[model samples]
Target: MTTMQLEIQAIAAVVAAACALPGVFLVLRRTAMLSDAISHTVLLGIVLAYFWVQDLASPALILGAAATGLLTVWLVELLVGTRLVKEDAAIGLVFPVLFSVAVILISRYARGVHLDVDAVLLGELAFAPFERLTLLGLDLPTALWVMGGILLLNLVVIGLFFKELKLATFDAGLAAALGFAPALVHYGLMALVSVTAVGAFDAVGSILVVALMITPAATAYLLTDDLRAMLGWSVGIGVASAISGYWLARALDGNIAGAMASMTGIFFVVGLLFAPERGLVAVAQRRMRQRWEFAQTLLAVHLLQHEGLPENRVESRVDHLVEHIRWQPVYAEQVIRYAERKGVVRRREGRLYLTDDGRRLAEQMVARA
Candidate 1:
């Protein structure tokens, strides 16, 4: 691979890892939509800051964007807390309006400027590697330094307050009762998300930020129950998506960030179908096994019930299984075969009878009931 390709992948990996870290907590807290809100509304902050400072390179832009992100969160929370609007409704009301204003302002006033909606929304990762930053005596891609710093910030925040974040995410009420200040932890997490989004969006775009922030974490959530494992899984998934996505984009001659975002969806679909305990296929298998076990138990109980009664003796016969137990013929045959395999039933003279172990189980079932 060329040096440029490696640089692009490195930047994508850093951006994905940074976004995915806070994303774990966001997914756990069921606040994933907040990333989308912050990503869009932060544009208005940037535009307003640009107008104030009249300089695109000033740090004020990031500060303004971060403030706008926090404002979006505060507004949604305020509206939700008042019980006047639901959380989703509050998000729906806030982000679109802010984003539209930012778009209109850009169109009306900054038409000749470097800022464009495409860069803000979709990004141009292909060009990111060309923007070099000179640190001391070494030259590095600007995205590397920017995304790397944000990645470090996110790591430090998570490392320092892992316990508090965990408690606040899983059980806010319990955390509050225990003097953890869930509200503070929540805002702190939002702040980290805001900062990460701003730093990464310039390279990967806001859409990619939202996708990376939520998708990998959500996929990981499906795969693990332990919080630390979930976080580790999410980071791994994010890095894989970034590297794979770069290759996908190269193969298709398409957008790198979009390719990586697509990979996140692919990974999530795999998890949805194949995760050990929580996946759709696994859950279906468990339920089917449970149904079969219950059917076998009922079959054993019915055979034991008719064992010595003359009038009900025919009920223990294979031919009477369907009519006596109100089972379909095919179902009755299946249960009989299964029971025989389990050594729970024996067939002789075309009649079925429970074995010694089966009789004991039937007795125990009756006793328990």
Candidate 2:
């Protein structure tokens, strides 16, 4: 690989990792859409910051974007607090106005300027290496430092407040009852998400920022029940998506950010189909096994019910199962064989009889019901 391709991959990986850290909690909280809202609204923040400072490279631009992201969340919460709109509705209402206003400003006043809407929506990662930052006598891509700093900040903050974050995410009522201030934790997470979004805006664009943030974490959720395991899996999945998507883009001569987003979707599909306990295939297998076992239990119960009754004895033969239970021929045969193997029923002459063990089990099953 060329140096540029390697650098782009490295930047994408770092951005993915940074976004995925808080994204786990976002997914758990069902607030994944907030990433989309904050990412888009942050553009307004960047534009306003640019107008004030007349400089795109200033740190104040990031601060403005971060603050704008926080404002978006607060506005949504405020609208929700008014009880006139739901959370999703509030987000939908707020972000479009902010984003459209920014777009209008860009077209009206900054049309001939370097800032372009297409660049903000879909970043040009190939040119990322050209924007260099010289740090400690080594020149590196600016996105690498920006994303790396955000990644470190997310790790430290999440590590320090892991317990509180967990409690706030899963059980806000309990957290509030215990004086943990769930509201503060929620807003803190929003703040971090906004900062992460801004950090990634230059490399992956605002659109893919939400993809890298939410998709890997969601895929990890399907694979594990443990939060720590989910976090680890999410990081691994994000890095894997970055690396694999880089190669995919190279192969197809396609958009790298779009390829990375597509890879995240592929990972989620794999989890949905192949996760050990919760996957669709495993779930179907479990349901089928349950039906088979229940069918065998029904056969045993039927045999026990007809035992010691001369009138019903003629109806207790194995052939009567299809007529009595309405089971398909193949299914009835399978259930009968299973019952015999379990010693729940015995065949004597042409009749089926329940064993002593079978009678006891049938009675217990009835009692439990």
On TM-score, the leading prediction is 1
lDDT of 2 at 314: 72
lDDT per residue for candidate 2 within 1-369, as digits (tens), equals 788888999998998899889999999999999999999999999999999998989888899999999999999999999999988899999999999999999999878778898899888777788989989897899989888999999999999999999989888999999999998998899999989998888888999999999999999998999999999999999999988998999899998889999999999899999989999999999999888778877877787777778756677877788889998888887887888888888888867888888888888878888
Q: Give the distance in Å from residue 246's predicted Cα in candidate 2 to where it truly belongs.
A: 0.7
lDDT of 1 at 329: 91
Poorest 10 consecutive residues by lDDT, candidate 1: 311-320
| TM-score attained by model 2 | 0.92
- lDDT per residue as tens, model 1, 1-369: 889988999999999999999999999898999999999999998999999999987779888999899999999989899999999999999899889999999999988898898898998889998899999787889889888988999999899999899989888899999999998998899989888888877888898899899999999999999999998999999999999999999999999989999999999999999999999999999999888889889988988787788955668778887777789999988988888898999988888889998899898998999
TM-score on alpha carbons, each prediction: 0.94, 0.92
Candidate 1 residues lying further than 4 Å off, grouped into runs, are 136-138, 308-313
RMSD (CA, Å), candidate 1 to true, equals 1.9
